[model samples]
Target: PGGVGRQLLQKPTPAPAQHPPVRYPLTGEPRILFWAQNFSVVQGSKWVDLTSQTFGAEASVDVSGSSWSSNDSRLVLKYANVLGSPLTATFHMTSRWFPVSGRDWFQLNRLELATPSARPTVFNASQVTAPSNYSWHCAHLSSLPGFGAGLRGHGPSPSWGVLLQDVQVPAGTPGFSPGSGRGSGREGLGGVLAGACLDEPFPPP
Candidate 1:
Protein backbone atom coordinates (compact mmCIF):
# COMPACT_ATOMS: atom_id res chain seq x y z
CA PRO A 1 0.00 0.00 0.00
CA GLY A 2 1.13 3.57 -0.62
CA GLY A 3 2.35 5.33 2.54
CA VAL A 4 4.49 8.40 3.38
CA GLY A 5 6.69 7.34 0.50
CA ARG A 6 3.73 7.86 -1.82
CA GLN A 7 3.01 11.26 -0.31
CA LEU A 8 6.66 12.26 -0.66
CA LEU A 9 6.70 11.12 -4.28
CA GLN A 10 3.32 12.65 -5.17
CA LYS A 11 4.53 16.21 -5.70
CA PRO A 12 8.17 16.71 -5.02
CA THR A 13 8.96 20.27 -4.02
CA PRO A 14 10.46 22.28 -6.86
CA ALA A 15 14.00 23.45 -6.06
CA PRO A 16 14.13 27.22 -5.72
CA ALA A 17 16.04 29.09 -8.43
CA GLN A 18 18.48 29.94 -5.68
CA HIS A 19 18.25 28.12 -2.39
CA PRO A 20 17.41 30.08 0.74
CA PRO A 21 20.34 31.98 2.27
CA VAL A 22 19.58 30.31 5.57
CA ARG A 23 20.96 27.13 4.08
CA TYR A 24 24.53 28.45 4.27
CA PRO A 25 26.51 27.80 7.40
CA LEU A 26 26.64 30.75 9.81
CA THR A 27 29.81 29.73 11.60
CA GLY A 28 33.33 29.32 10.16
CA GLU A 29 34.78 30.84 7.00
CA PRO A 30 34.21 29.08 3.67
CA ARG A 31 37.27 27.21 2.41
CA ILE A 32 38.35 24.18 0.36
CA LEU A 33 37.82 21.02 2.41
CA PHE A 34 39.38 18.29 0.25
CA TRP A 35 40.30 17.44 -3.35
CA ALA A 36 42.18 15.20 -5.79
CA GLN A 37 42.86 16.20 -9.40
CA ASN A 38 45.15 13.55 -10.89
CA PHE A 39 42.67 11.63 -13.00
CA SER A 40 42.29 11.75 -16.81
CA VAL A 41 38.96 12.28 -18.53
CA VAL A 42 37.09 9.01 -18.90
CA GLN A 43 33.41 9.78 -19.47
CA GLY A 44 30.47 11.58 -17.93
CA SER A 45 28.08 10.36 -15.29
CA LYS A 46 24.48 11.48 -14.73
CA TRP A 47 25.86 14.51 -12.84
CA VAL A 48 29.67 14.64 -13.11
CA ASP A 49 32.34 13.89 -15.66
CA LEU A 50 34.00 10.58 -14.98
CA THR A 51 37.82 10.51 -14.60
CA SER A 52 40.42 7.82 -15.28
CA GLN A 53 42.61 8.46 -12.26
CA THR A 54 42.98 5.16 -10.42
CA PHE A 55 44.87 4.46 -7.19
CA GLY A 56 48.53 5.13 -8.11
CA ALA A 57 46.56 6.76 -10.94
CA GLU A 58 43.24 6.81 -9.07
CA ALA A 59 39.91 8.69 -9.57
CA SER A 60 38.46 11.18 -7.07
CA VAL A 61 35.95 13.91 -6.20
CA ASP A 62 36.49 17.29 -4.62
CA VAL A 63 33.90 18.21 -1.94
CA SER A 64 32.79 21.85 -1.74
CA GLY A 65 29.90 24.00 -0.48
CA SER A 66 29.34 26.60 2.22
CA SER A 67 25.62 25.84 2.55
CA TRP A 68 22.89 23.27 2.11
CA SER A 69 19.20 22.76 1.29
CA SER A 70 16.71 19.92 1.67
CA ASN A 71 15.64 20.78 -1.83
CA ASP A 72 19.20 20.03 -2.96
CA SER A 73 20.01 16.58 -4.29
CA ARG A 74 22.44 14.04 -2.80
CA LEU A 75 26.11 14.10 -4.00
CA VAL A 76 28.34 11.12 -4.66
CA LEU A 77 32.04 11.17 -5.75
CA LYS A 78 33.34 7.85 -6.94
CA TYR A 79 36.43 5.95 -8.16
CA ALA A 80 36.95 2.52 -9.67
CA ASN A 81 39.73 0.48 -11.39
CA VAL A 82 39.35 -3.18 -10.47
CA LEU A 83 42.20 -4.36 -12.64
CA GLY A 84 44.07 -6.33 -10.01
CA SER A 85 44.02 -6.85 -6.23
CA PRO A 86 41.01 -5.88 -4.14
CA LEU A 87 40.84 -2.11 -3.56
CA THR A 88 38.16 -0.29 -1.58
CA ALA A 89 36.81 3.05 -0.27
CA THR A 90 33.97 4.26 1.90
CA PHE A 91 32.14 7.55 2.63
CA HIS A 92 30.51 8.71 5.88
CA MET A 93 28.49 11.91 6.24
CA THR A 94 26.73 14.01 8.94
CA SER A 95 24.60 17.19 8.93
CA ARG A 96 23.57 20.01 11.33
CA TRP A 97 20.85 22.71 11.44
CA PHE A 98 20.83 26.03 13.36
CA PRO A 99 17.83 28.21 14.14
CA VAL A 100 17.57 32.01 13.77
CA SER A 101 16.64 33.19 17.25
CA GLY A 102 17.96 30.93 19.94
CA ARG A 103 21.54 29.75 20.53
CA ASP A 104 20.09 26.30 19.97
CA TRP A 105 21.07 23.94 17.17
CA PHE A 106 21.27 20.19 16.93
CA GLN A 107 22.39 17.13 15.04
CA LEU A 108 20.21 15.88 12.17
CA ASN A 109 21.71 12.65 10.83
CA ARG A 110 24.80 10.54 10.09
CA LEU A 111 25.28 8.06 7.23
CA GLU A 112 28.07 5.51 6.77
CA LEU A 113 28.95 3.36 3.81
CA ALA A 114 27.80 -0.16 4.61
CA THR A 115 30.07 -1.94 2.17
CA PRO A 116 33.76 -1.40 2.75
CA SER A 117 34.90 -1.28 -0.90
CA ALA A 118 34.03 -2.17 -4.48
CA ARG A 119 34.33 -1.07 -8.09
CA PRO A 120 32.59 2.19 -9.00
CA THR A 121 33.04 2.96 -5.32
CA VAL A 122 31.15 5.97 -4.01
CA PHE A 123 31.11 8.39 -1.08
CA ASN A 124 27.96 9.91 0.38
CA ALA A 125 28.00 13.72 0.75
CA SER A 126 25.53 15.71 2.89
CA GLN A 127 23.47 18.92 2.97
CA VAL A 128 20.81 20.51 5.24
CA THR A 129 17.93 23.01 5.65
CA ALA A 130 16.39 25.03 8.47
CA PRO A 131 13.02 26.53 9.39
CA SER A 132 12.07 29.91 7.88
CA ASN A 133 13.06 31.63 11.11
CA TYR A 134 16.54 30.14 11.04
CA SER A 135 19.58 31.84 9.57
CA TRP A 136 21.93 29.13 8.22
CA HIS A 137 22.73 25.45 8.02
CA CYS A 138 26.00 25.94 10.03
CA ALA A 139 27.63 23.02 8.27
CA HIS A 140 30.98 22.36 6.51
CA LEU A 141 32.94 19.39 5.20
CA SER A 142 35.38 19.75 8.05
CA SER A 143 38.36 17.44 8.43
CA LEU A 144 36.84 15.99 11.56
CA PRO A 145 38.82 12.83 12.51
CA GLY A 146 36.36 10.19 11.31
CA PHE A 147 34.99 12.24 8.39
CA GLY A 148 36.14 10.87 5.03
CA ALA A 149 38.10 8.42 7.11
CA GLY A 150 41.76 9.40 7.68
CA LEU A 151 41.77 10.88 4.19
CA ARG A 152 40.66 14.18 5.73
CA GLY A 153 41.64 15.58 9.09
CA HIS A 154 41.49 18.62 11.43
CA GLY A 155 42.00 20.82 8.36
CA PRO A 156 41.68 20.69 4.58
CA SER A 157 42.81 17.43 3.02
CA PRO A 158 44.79 18.41 -0.10
CA SER A 159 44.21 15.41 -2.42
CA TRP A 160 41.55 13.09 -1.13
CA GLY A 161 38.41 12.03 -3.01
CA VAL A 162 34.95 12.44 -1.46
CA LEU A 163 31.26 13.28 -2.11
CA LEU A 164 28.29 14.67 -0.16
CA GLN A 165 25.08 12.58 -0.37
CA ASP A 166 22.76 12.86 2.64
CA VAL A 167 20.44 15.88 3.14
CA GLN A 168 18.88 15.51 6.58
CA VAL A 169 17.86 18.40 8.86
CA PRO A 170 16.22 19.01 12.22
CA ALA A 171 12.62 19.66 11.18
CA GLY A 172 11.17 19.66 14.75
CA THR A 173 8.73 16.89 13.99
CA PRO A 174 8.01 13.49 15.45
CA GLY A 175 10.10 10.69 13.95
CA PHE A 176 12.61 13.33 12.88
CA SER A 177 15.52 11.85 14.79
CA PRO A 178 18.80 13.64 15.52
CA GLY A 179 22.05 12.65 17.30
CA SER A 180 22.75 9.98 14.71
CA GLY A 181 26.53 10.14 14.10
CA ARG A 182 29.89 10.26 15.89
CA GLY A 183 29.96 14.05 16.36
CA SER A 184 26.21 14.63 15.95
CA GLY A 185 25.47 13.14 19.39
CA ARG A 186 26.31 16.61 20.70
CA GLU A 187 24.61 19.90 19.98
CA GLY A 188 26.17 22.34 17.49
CA LEU A 189 27.90 19.54 15.57
CA GLY A 190 28.09 18.86 11.84
CA GLY A 191 30.08 19.66 8.66
CA VAL A 192 29.67 20.94 5.08
CA LEU A 193 31.40 20.69 1.69
CA ALA A 194 33.69 23.65 1.00
CA GLY A 195 35.14 23.13 -2.53
CA ALA A 196 36.15 20.64 -5.18
CA CYS A 197 39.72 19.68 -6.14
CA LEU A 198 41.29 20.94 -9.35
CA ASP A 199 41.70 18.56 -12.28
CA GLU A 200 42.95 20.64 -15.17
CA PRO A 201 46.39 22.26 -15.21
CA PHE A 202 44.72 25.63 -14.96
CA PRO A 203 46.66 28.45 -13.30
CA PRO A 204 46.14 28.96 -9.57
CA PRO A 205 44.25 32.04 -8.43
Candidate 2:
Protein backbone atom coordinates (compact mmCIF):
# COMPACT_ATOMS: atom_id res chain seq x y z
CA PRO A 1 0.00 0.00 0.00
CA GLY A 2 2.80 2.46 0.74
CA GLY A 3 4.51 1.65 -2.57
CA VAL A 4 1.20 2.30 -4.45
CA GLY A 5 0.75 5.66 -2.71
CA ARG A 6 4.37 6.63 -3.59
CA GLN A 7 3.78 5.82 -7.25
CA LEU A 8 0.66 8.01 -7.33
CA LEU A 9 2.56 10.91 -5.72
CA GLN A 10 5.58 10.84 -8.08
CA LYS A 11 5.46 14.27 -9.85
CA PRO A 12 2.12 13.60 -11.67
CA THR A 13 4.08 12.18 -14.65
CA PRO A 14 5.50 15.61 -15.71
CA ALA A 15 3.27 17.91 -17.78
CA PRO A 16 3.80 18.15 -21.52
CA ALA A 17 6.28 20.78 -22.78
CA GLN A 18 4.75 24.20 -23.53
CA HIS A 19 5.87 25.89 -26.73
CA PRO A 20 5.73 29.59 -27.73
CA PRO A 21 3.07 30.75 -30.13
CA VAL A 22 3.93 31.01 -33.82
CA ARG A 23 4.09 34.42 -35.51
CA TYR A 24 3.21 35.03 -39.16
CA PRO A 25 5.18 37.40 -41.38
CA LEU A 26 3.74 40.66 -42.54
CA THR A 27 3.66 42.08 -46.08
CA GLY A 28 5.66 45.34 -46.17
CA GLU A 29 4.69 46.38 -49.67
CA PRO A 30 3.70 50.03 -50.16
CA ARG A 31 0.11 50.87 -51.16
CA ILE A 32 -1.78 54.08 -51.84
CA LEU A 33 -5.36 54.68 -50.66
CA PHE A 34 -7.36 57.59 -52.02
CA TRP A 35 -10.99 58.72 -52.21
CA ALA A 36 -13.11 61.78 -53.01
CA GLN A 37 -15.51 63.87 -50.93
CA ASN A 38 -17.87 66.85 -51.20
CA PHE A 39 -18.61 65.67 -54.71
CA SER A 40 -21.62 67.57 -55.95
CA VAL A 41 -22.57 69.01 -59.28
CA VAL A 42 -24.18 72.37 -59.88
CA GLN A 43 -27.20 72.58 -62.18
CA GLY A 44 -26.19 72.84 -65.86
CA SER A 45 -22.85 71.18 -65.12
CA LYS A 46 -23.03 68.24 -67.47
CA TRP A 47 -19.75 66.65 -66.47
CA VAL A 48 -17.05 66.73 -63.79
CA ASP A 49 -13.46 65.67 -64.18
CA LEU A 50 -11.81 63.59 -61.47
CA THR A 51 -8.13 62.81 -61.39
CA SER A 52 -5.96 60.60 -59.16
CA GLN A 53 -2.18 60.78 -59.22
CA THR A 54 0.41 58.67 -57.43
CA PHE A 55 3.50 56.52 -57.96
CA GLY A 56 4.33 58.46 -61.12
CA ALA A 57 1.01 57.46 -62.75
CA GLU A 58 -2.17 59.44 -63.28
CA ALA A 59 -5.84 58.35 -63.75
CA SER A 60 -8.58 60.66 -64.95
CA VAL A 61 -12.33 60.20 -65.21
CA ASP A 62 -14.93 62.44 -66.82
CA VAL A 63 -18.14 61.85 -64.86
CA SER A 64 -21.27 62.74 -66.82
CA GLY A 65 -25.06 62.36 -66.66
CA SER A 66 -27.59 62.83 -63.89
CA SER A 67 -27.83 59.14 -63.05
CA TRP A 68 -24.31 59.13 -61.61
CA SER A 69 -25.32 61.83 -59.17
CA SER A 70 -28.43 59.97 -58.07
CA ASN A 71 -26.70 56.84 -56.80
CA ASP A 72 -23.44 55.41 -55.43
CA SER A 73 -20.78 54.61 -58.04
CA ARG A 74 -17.30 53.12 -57.74
CA LEU A 75 -14.21 53.30 -59.97
CA VAL A 76 -11.12 51.10 -59.82
CA LEU A 77 -7.91 51.33 -61.80
CA LYS A 78 -5.01 48.86 -62.02
CA TYR A 79 -1.50 49.48 -63.23
CA ALA A 80 1.68 47.50 -63.49
CA ASN A 81 3.50 47.59 -60.16
CA VAL A 82 5.13 50.98 -60.46
CA LEU A 83 7.48 49.96 -57.66
CA GLY A 84 8.67 46.89 -59.55
CA SER A 85 12.18 46.92 -60.96
CA PRO A 86 11.59 45.83 -64.56
CA LEU A 87 8.21 47.65 -64.88
CA THR A 88 6.27 45.04 -66.86
CA ALA A 89 2.76 45.55 -65.43
CA THR A 90 0.06 46.81 -67.79
CA PHE A 91 -2.39 49.68 -67.06
CA HIS A 92 -6.19 49.45 -67.01
CA MET A 93 -9.30 50.81 -65.28
CA THR A 94 -12.48 49.11 -64.05
CA SER A 95 -15.71 50.77 -62.97
CA ARG A 96 -18.47 49.15 -60.92
CA TRP A 97 -21.93 50.35 -61.92
CA PHE A 98 -24.88 49.92 -59.58
CA PRO A 99 -28.56 50.64 -59.93
CA VAL A 100 -29.59 54.22 -59.18
CA SER A 101 -32.85 53.35 -57.49
CA GLY A 102 -34.08 50.97 -54.75
CA ARG A 103 -32.23 49.39 -51.80
CA ASP A 104 -28.94 49.31 -53.61
CA TRP A 105 -28.87 53.08 -53.37
CA PHE A 106 -28.55 53.01 -49.58
CA GLN A 107 -25.94 50.29 -49.18
CA LEU A 108 -22.23 51.13 -49.38
CA ASN A 109 -20.36 48.42 -51.24
CA ARG A 110 -16.70 47.52 -51.73
CA LEU A 111 -14.64 48.12 -54.86
CA GLU A 112 -12.17 45.69 -56.44
CA LEU A 113 -8.88 46.15 -58.28
CA ALA A 114 -7.45 43.31 -60.36
CA THR A 115 -4.38 42.69 -62.47
CA PRO A 116 -3.71 40.15 -65.18
CA SER A 117 -0.91 38.50 -63.21
CA ALA A 118 -2.28 38.75 -59.63
CA ARG A 119 -5.45 38.60 -57.60
CA PRO A 120 -7.79 41.53 -57.00
CA THR A 121 -7.65 44.13 -54.21
CA VAL A 122 -10.78 45.38 -52.49
CA PHE A 123 -11.36 48.80 -50.92
CA ASN A 124 -14.33 49.76 -48.80
CA ALA A 125 -15.79 53.05 -47.59
CA SER A 126 -14.72 52.21 -44.05
CA GLN A 127 -11.07 52.62 -45.03
CA VAL A 128 -11.47 56.23 -46.15
CA THR A 129 -9.89 58.95 -43.99
CA ALA A 130 -10.88 62.48 -43.07
CA PRO A 131 -11.37 64.85 -45.95
CA SER A 132 -8.78 67.44 -46.97
CA ASN A 133 -9.46 70.58 -49.03
CA TYR A 134 -7.34 70.03 -52.09
CA SER A 135 -8.40 72.06 -55.12
CA TRP A 136 -9.82 69.76 -57.80
CA HIS A 137 -10.83 71.50 -60.98
CA CYS A 138 -12.73 70.28 -64.02
CA ALA A 139 -10.96 70.33 -67.33
CA HIS A 140 -12.61 71.91 -70.38
CA LEU A 141 -11.71 70.50 -73.75
CA SER A 142 -12.09 72.93 -76.64
CA SER A 143 -13.14 70.08 -78.90
CA LEU A 144 -16.05 69.24 -76.56
CA PRO A 145 -17.60 72.70 -76.80
CA GLY A 146 -18.18 73.38 -73.09
CA PHE A 147 -16.91 75.80 -70.43
CA GLY A 148 -13.15 75.82 -69.81
CA ALA A 149 -12.03 73.43 -67.06
CA GLY A 150 -11.44 75.08 -63.67
CA LEU A 151 -7.94 73.96 -62.64
CA ARG A 152 -6.44 75.78 -65.60
CA GLY A 153 -9.15 78.15 -66.78
CA HIS A 154 -11.21 80.66 -64.79
CA GLY A 155 -14.10 78.24 -65.45
CA PRO A 156 -16.29 77.12 -62.59
CA SER A 157 -14.60 77.49 -59.20
CA PRO A 158 -12.42 74.52 -58.32
CA SER A 159 -13.90 71.75 -56.23
CA TRP A 160 -12.24 69.71 -53.51
CA GLY A 161 -9.79 67.11 -54.72
CA VAL A 162 -9.25 63.53 -53.51
CA LEU A 163 -7.26 62.66 -50.40
CA LEU A 164 -4.28 60.39 -50.91
CA GLN A 165 -2.61 58.32 -48.20
CA ASP A 166 0.01 55.58 -48.06
CA VAL A 167 -0.91 52.39 -46.26
CA GLN A 168 0.73 49.01 -45.64
CA VAL A 169 -0.80 45.60 -45.20
CA PRO A 170 0.02 43.45 -42.17
CA ALA A 171 2.47 40.61 -42.46
CA GLY A 172 1.16 37.53 -44.30
CA THR A 173 -1.04 39.65 -46.53
CA PRO A 174 -1.82 37.56 -49.62
CA GLY A 175 -0.94 38.29 -53.25
CA PHE A 176 1.85 40.65 -52.19
CA SER A 177 4.80 38.66 -53.43
CA PRO A 178 5.81 39.26 -57.04
CA GLY A 179 4.10 36.40 -58.90
CA SER A 180 2.83 34.81 -55.72
CA GLY A 181 -0.51 34.92 -57.57
CA ARG A 182 -2.46 33.72 -54.56
CA GLY A 183 -5.56 35.33 -53.18
CA SER A 184 -5.01 37.17 -49.89
CA GLY A 185 -8.64 36.48 -48.93
CA ARG A 186 -8.66 40.06 -47.69
CA GLU A 187 -10.05 42.88 -49.83
CA GLY A 188 -7.53 44.92 -51.80
CA LEU A 189 -7.39 48.12 -53.88
CA GLY A 190 -8.12 48.11 -57.61
CA GLY A 191 -9.33 50.47 -60.34
CA VAL A 192 -12.87 51.49 -59.35
CA LEU A 193 -15.30 54.46 -59.35
CA ALA A 194 -17.87 54.59 -56.59
CA GLY A 195 -20.25 57.16 -55.13
CA ALA A 196 -20.83 57.22 -51.38
CA CYS A 197 -21.04 59.60 -48.44
CA LEU A 198 -17.74 60.77 -47.03
CA ASP A 199 -16.65 62.40 -43.79
CA GLU A 200 -18.16 65.89 -43.66
CA PRO A 201 -16.36 68.73 -45.38
CA PHE A 202 -13.91 66.37 -47.05
CA PRO A 203 -12.78 69.32 -49.13
CA PRO A 204 -12.85 71.22 -45.83
CA PRO A 205 -14.74 74.47 -45.24
Candidate 3:
Protein backbone atom coordinates (compact mmCIF):
# COMPACT_ATOMS: atom_id res chain seq x y z
CA PRO A 1 0.00 0.00 0.00
CA GLY A 2 2.79 2.46 0.82
CA GLY A 3 4.68 1.72 -2.45
CA VAL A 4 1.47 2.14 -4.52
CA GLY A 5 0.75 5.54 -2.84
CA ARG A 6 4.34 6.78 -3.54
CA GLN A 7 4.06 5.87 -7.23
CA LEU A 8 0.74 7.72 -7.55
CA LEU A 9 2.21 11.05 -6.19
CA GLN A 10 5.39 11.85 -8.15
CA LYS A 11 7.71 14.70 -7.21
CA PRO A 12 6.93 18.00 -8.91
CA THR A 13 9.45 19.98 -11.00
CA PRO A 14 10.92 23.20 -9.62
CA ALA A 15 9.51 26.43 -10.94
CA PRO A 16 11.65 29.21 -12.40
CA ALA A 17 12.60 32.21 -10.34
CA GLN A 18 10.46 35.30 -10.61
CA HIS A 19 11.63 38.91 -10.20
CA PRO A 20 9.59 41.82 -8.86
CA PRO A 21 8.97 44.93 -10.93
CA VAL A 22 11.77 47.50 -10.73
CA ARG A 23 10.98 50.95 -9.34
CA TYR A 24 13.76 53.08 -10.75
CA PRO A 25 17.39 51.96 -10.85
CA LEU A 26 18.05 51.80 -7.14
CA THR A 27 18.21 49.10 -4.52
CA GLY A 28 16.23 48.66 -1.30
CA GLU A 29 12.77 50.16 -0.66
CA PRO A 30 11.41 53.34 -2.25
CA ARG A 31 10.93 56.45 -0.09
CA ILE A 32 9.10 59.74 -0.32
CA LEU A 33 11.68 62.40 0.48
CA PHE A 34 9.14 65.13 -0.25
CA TRP A 35 5.50 65.70 -1.16
CA ALA A 36 2.66 68.21 -1.64
CA GLN A 37 -1.09 67.66 -1.90
CA ASN A 38 -3.65 69.08 -4.33
CA PHE A 39 -4.01 72.83 -4.99
CA SER A 40 -6.41 72.67 -2.06
CA VAL A 41 -3.35 73.51 0.07
CA VAL A 42 -3.10 76.83 -1.73
CA GLN A 43 -5.98 79.18 -0.98
CA GLY A 44 -5.45 82.16 -3.22
CA SER A 45 -7.20 82.19 -6.58
CA LYS A 46 -5.23 84.75 -8.64
CA TRP A 47 -1.94 82.97 -7.84
CA VAL A 48 -0.75 79.95 -5.91
CA ASP A 49 2.81 79.21 -4.81
CA LEU A 50 3.96 75.94 -3.29
CA THR A 51 7.54 76.03 -2.04
CA SER A 52 9.82 73.08 -1.28
CA GLN A 53 12.72 74.33 0.83
CA THR A 54 13.11 71.23 2.95
CA PHE A 55 15.59 69.15 0.96
CA GLY A 56 18.78 70.69 2.43
CA ALA A 57 20.68 73.91 3.00
CA GLU A 58 21.91 73.71 -0.57
CA ALA A 59 18.28 73.50 -1.69
CA SER A 60 16.16 76.64 -1.74
CA VAL A 61 13.16 77.71 -3.86
CA ASP A 62 11.55 81.00 -4.85
CA VAL A 63 8.43 80.30 -6.82
CA SER A 64 5.19 82.26 -7.22
CA GLY A 65 2.95 79.44 -8.47
CA SER A 66 2.51 75.74 -9.19
CA SER A 67 1.59 73.42 -12.07
CA TRP A 68 -0.93 71.41 -10.14
CA SER A 69 -3.82 71.13 -12.57
CA SER A 70 -2.01 72.02 -15.76
CA ASN A 71 0.73 69.98 -17.42
CA ASP A 72 -0.30 66.85 -15.52
CA SER A 73 0.83 68.27 -12.19
CA ARG A 74 4.51 67.96 -13.08
CA LEU A 75 7.44 70.26 -12.38
CA VAL A 76 11.20 70.22 -12.83
CA LEU A 77 13.37 72.15 -10.40
CA LYS A 78 17.09 72.57 -11.06
CA TYR A 79 19.43 74.16 -8.55
CA ALA A 80 22.49 75.52 -10.21
CA ASN A 81 25.91 76.22 -8.60
CA VAL A 82 24.23 75.04 -5.41
CA LEU A 83 24.86 78.01 -3.14
CA GLY A 84 28.64 78.25 -2.53
CA SER A 85 29.47 74.89 -4.10
CA PRO A 86 29.52 73.89 -7.77
CA LEU A 87 27.00 71.07 -7.75
CA THR A 88 23.54 70.69 -9.26
CA ALA A 89 20.51 68.43 -8.87
CA THR A 90 17.22 68.19 -10.71
CA PHE A 91 13.99 67.30 -8.95
CA HIS A 92 11.53 65.67 -11.32
CA MET A 93 8.16 66.31 -9.74
CA THR A 94 5.24 63.98 -10.50
CA SER A 95 1.89 63.26 -8.85
CA ARG A 96 -0.65 60.58 -7.98
CA TRP A 97 -4.22 61.20 -8.98
CA PHE A 98 -7.50 59.86 -7.66
CA PRO A 99 -11.03 59.76 -9.05
CA VAL A 100 -13.67 62.13 -7.69
CA SER A 101 -17.16 62.63 -9.16
CA GLY A 102 -16.04 61.26 -12.52
CA ARG A 103 -12.99 63.51 -12.53
CA ASP A 104 -9.41 63.20 -11.24
CA TRP A 105 -7.49 65.42 -8.85
CA PHE A 106 -3.81 65.55 -8.05
CA GLN A 107 -2.57 63.75 -4.96
CA LEU A 108 0.80 64.17 -3.29
CA ASN A 109 2.91 61.40 -4.77
CA ARG A 110 6.40 60.33 -5.92
CA LEU A 111 9.39 62.35 -6.92
CA GLU A 112 12.16 61.25 -9.32
CA LEU A 113 15.68 62.54 -8.77
CA ALA A 114 18.30 62.87 -11.50
CA THR A 115 21.81 64.01 -10.79
CA PRO A 116 25.10 63.88 -12.64
CA SER A 117 25.51 60.39 -11.18
CA ALA A 118 25.11 57.20 -13.15
CA ARG A 119 21.69 56.27 -11.76
CA PRO A 120 18.56 58.09 -10.61
CA THR A 121 16.65 57.90 -7.31
CA VAL A 122 12.88 57.72 -6.77
CA PHE A 123 10.97 58.99 -3.72
CA ASN A 124 7.65 57.28 -3.14
CA ALA A 125 4.96 59.30 -1.38
CA SER A 126 4.15 56.54 1.11
CA GLN A 127 7.66 56.01 2.47
CA VAL A 128 9.31 59.30 3.49
CA THR A 129 8.25 62.29 5.57
CA ALA A 130 8.74 66.03 5.46
CA PRO A 131 12.33 66.67 6.48
CA SER A 132 13.21 68.98 9.38
CA ASN A 133 14.76 71.42 6.93
CA TYR A 134 11.47 71.73 5.05
CA SER A 135 9.83 75.14 4.99
CA TRP A 136 6.66 76.36 3.26
CA HIS A 137 4.54 79.50 3.04
CA CYS A 138 1.01 79.22 1.58
CA ALA A 139 -1.30 82.21 1.26
CA HIS A 140 -4.64 82.85 -0.42
CA LEU A 141 -4.79 85.38 -3.17
CA SER A 142 -6.01 88.77 -2.03
CA SER A 143 -8.91 90.22 -3.95
CA LEU A 144 -8.03 93.19 -6.12
CA PRO A 145 -11.44 94.85 -6.11
CA GLY A 146 -10.73 97.04 -9.11
CA PHE A 147 -7.76 95.58 -11.01
CA GLY A 148 -8.90 94.14 -14.33
CA ALA A 149 -11.80 95.01 -16.61
CA GLY A 150 -15.13 93.59 -15.42
CA LEU A 151 -13.32 92.20 -12.44
CA ARG A 152 -15.60 91.64 -9.49
CA GLY A 153 -12.85 90.33 -7.20
CA HIS A 154 -9.38 88.84 -7.73
CA GLY A 155 -9.48 85.07 -8.22
CA PRO A 156 -7.80 82.41 -10.29
CA SER A 157 -8.90 81.80 -13.84
CA PRO A 158 -10.23 78.45 -14.97
CA SER A 159 -6.93 77.43 -16.53
CA TRP A 160 -4.51 80.08 -15.20
CA GLY A 161 -4.19 78.97 -11.59
CA VAL A 162 -1.97 75.93 -12.06
CA LEU A 163 1.36 76.07 -13.92
CA LEU A 164 3.72 73.14 -14.46
CA GLN A 165 7.09 73.05 -16.15
CA ASP A 166 7.07 71.80 -19.75
CA VAL A 167 10.38 69.99 -19.51
CA GLN A 168 10.80 66.26 -20.15
CA VAL A 169 12.74 63.99 -17.77
CA PRO A 170 12.87 60.56 -19.33
CA ALA A 171 13.89 57.60 -17.18
CA GLY A 172 16.57 57.16 -19.81
CA THR A 173 17.31 54.21 -22.06
CA PRO A 174 19.67 51.44 -21.01
CA GLY A 175 23.02 50.95 -22.78
CA PHE A 176 22.20 53.89 -25.01
CA SER A 177 22.63 57.31 -23.42
CA PRO A 178 25.61 58.66 -21.50
CA GLY A 179 26.51 56.63 -18.40
CA SER A 180 23.59 54.23 -18.96
CA GLY A 181 25.03 50.73 -18.77
CA ARG A 182 26.00 50.52 -15.10
CA GLY A 183 24.60 49.23 -11.80
CA SER A 184 23.19 45.79 -10.89
CA GLY A 185 22.93 43.44 -13.90
CA ARG A 186 23.46 46.49 -16.11
CA GLU A 187 19.78 47.44 -15.53
CA GLY A 188 18.98 51.05 -16.40
CA LEU A 189 16.16 53.29 -15.16
CA GLY A 190 15.36 54.42 -18.68
CA GLY A 191 12.67 51.76 -18.94
CA VAL A 192 11.43 52.38 -15.41
CA LEU A 193 11.56 56.13 -14.80
CA ALA A 194 11.07 57.44 -18.32
CA GLY A 195 7.46 56.25 -18.46
CA ALA A 196 6.74 54.65 -15.11
CA CYS A 197 4.20 57.24 -14.01
CA LEU A 198 0.82 55.87 -15.04
CA ASP A 199 -1.45 57.99 -17.20
CA GLU A 200 -4.66 59.45 -15.84
CA PRO A 201 -7.13 62.20 -16.75
CA PHE A 202 -5.29 65.50 -16.93
CA PRO A 203 -6.30 68.95 -15.61
CA PRO A 204 -7.55 67.35 -12.48
CA PRO A 205 -10.63 69.02 -11.12
* Candidate with maximal TM-score: 3
The local distance difference test score of each candidate is: 0.27, 0.23, 0.27
lDDT of 3 by residue, 1-205 (tens): 9998998898877632222211222233322122222111111444433222312233254211223332234444443333222222223333333344333223334443334632434433322111111211111111132321111212223212222211112221111121121232213323442312322111111
**Taking the tens digit of each residue's C-alpha lDDT, what string does model 1 give over 49-159?**
232332122324222322233332222223333222222332332333445544332222222221233224232223322332221222223223333331222222222
For every model shown, what is its TM-score relative to the native structure? 0.21, 0.23, 0.24
Which portions of model 3 miss their true places by more than 4 Å? 1-71, 83-103, 126-205
- lDDT score for residue 112 of model 1: 26
**RMSD of each candidate?**
18.5, 22.5, 21.1
Clash number for every model?
22, 25, 12
Worst 10 residues of 1 by lDDT: 196-205
